[model samples]
Target: MKDTVVEVKSLDQEWARLILEAKKIGLTKEEIRAFLVSTKEL
Candidate 1:
């Protein structure tokens, strides 16, 4: 999981953008969240 204190100042906007992009790419919320988590680990 990502550190909670990393600061999500633009998280809402970021998430909104991600959701829109995901929709275009046919990605579901679960897939998006998993991808985020996996990327964070890297």
Candidate 2:
């Protein structure tokens, strides 16, 4: 899939912060992928 950047409003910073916190606690890439797959709003 061709990946591209799209402009979004303020929420990106919050997402980045959450991801950084998750990394500090050792959330695996696979786990994150599974969570996103199971999450409808994602």
Candidate 3:
């Protein structure tokens, strides 16, 4: 519904902000992806 769409959009923004912050600290895309994939197994 409308609420779900709004929540997803908010999450997208938060994720974008986190990724930007990670990049600022010199984290590479492959490292980020590997970390995320590892978390999925937990």
lDDT (C-alpha, whole model) for all candidates: 0.82, 0.74, 0.83
Global Cα lDDT for candidate 2? 0.74
lDDT of 3 by residue, 1-42 (tens): 354335878888997898888889999999878876887899
- Which 10 successive residues of model 3 have the least lDDT summed? 1-10
**Lowest summed lDDT window (length 10), candidate 2:** 6-15
Residue lDDT tens for model 1, 1-42: 875764476877887797799989998878888888897888
RMSD to truth, every model: 5.9, 7.9, 4.0
The TM-score between candidate 2 and the true structure equals: 0.54
Scored by lDDT, the top model is 3
Whole-model lDDT for model 1 versus the true structure? 0.82
Ranking by TM-score: 3, 2, 1
Off by over 4 Å in 3: 1-6
- Candidate 2 lDDT by residue in tens digits, 1-42: 999776675567776777777778999978766766777675
